[model samples]
Target: MEAFFYIVPSLMIAALLSGVWRLMRRSRRVARAWGGGRTAQARCLRSYTTTSGGGDTMVSTTLHHVYEFTTREGRAVRFEEANGPGTTLEGDLVTVHYAAGHPEEATATAPAPGRLLAESGCLLLFLGVAIAFCVLFMVTAHEMFAETDGLMP
Candidate 1:
């Protein structure tokens, strides 16, 4: 059981690192293929839904919000500006930045504070907890092995 715990963590970390590496490589490759143009913005529409269990009433909302622009070629990209709410409505026009080389490679011209913060926080928290657990497992396993081997006796 101790050995299993020790090995599982190492395997998990290895898998995670490999997956991240692959994603980064793929993102870079797509960015390069898009000619890297950075000036473009487009509006995206999203629909929100609300559900109620009382009676037979279900409500779905189709609100149009302007999402950050993304290029067709590379990985999706969105941008938000520092001023005002970065998100825009369906009919709202936004400026996008693109790579000059790839005029089609563009993102919205603003920063998405809420999305960025939430995503970053979740990622950090998950990684931190995962690593801590893995380290703890390793330490426990080492102690178990030492005791079983009569090293401390």
Candidate 2:
């Protein structure tokens, strides 16, 4: 039972760390790709809200914006921005960055340094708290088992 308690939290923390690492890696790749890409004016086509986590948990909503832009080669491409919707409206002109080879993978917004810092800080904070709780639970379980063993025979 004590082993199970320790193993479960350890697994959970490992999984969380893996997910965070993957997200950071993908963000860096996209940022690098956009840095050398060309910029063009894109028009906002529409906006829609996506909702998740409804039952028993706090419902979260994200607004997605679809945009259309024409490349220098006169190719028309439409794609939804990866980030949530901004202050853009229908038919509004926004700046888009796209690589010459992959115009479909365009982005209207670049990752902000401040936002990235905040996200990293939050992840660190959560990791610290989770590790602390796991340690506390393991210590408590060890003490209880020790006391029971001492009482027997």
Top candidate, metric lDDT = 2
How many residue pairs clash in each candidate at the backbone level?
A: 19, 0
* 5 Cα displacement, candidate 1 (Å): 3.3
Per-residue lDDT of model 1, residues 1-153, tens digit only = 656766888998777666556555534534443434445556554423333355567654333233455555655554332223334545566666556555433444344446545655566567667777878888877887788883432
* Model 2 CA deviation exceeding 4 Å by range: 100-102, 121-125, 128-153
Against the true structure, candidate 1 reaches a TM-score of 0.43
TM-score for every candidate vs. truth?
A: 0.43, 0.67
How many Å off is the CA of 26 in candidate 1? 10
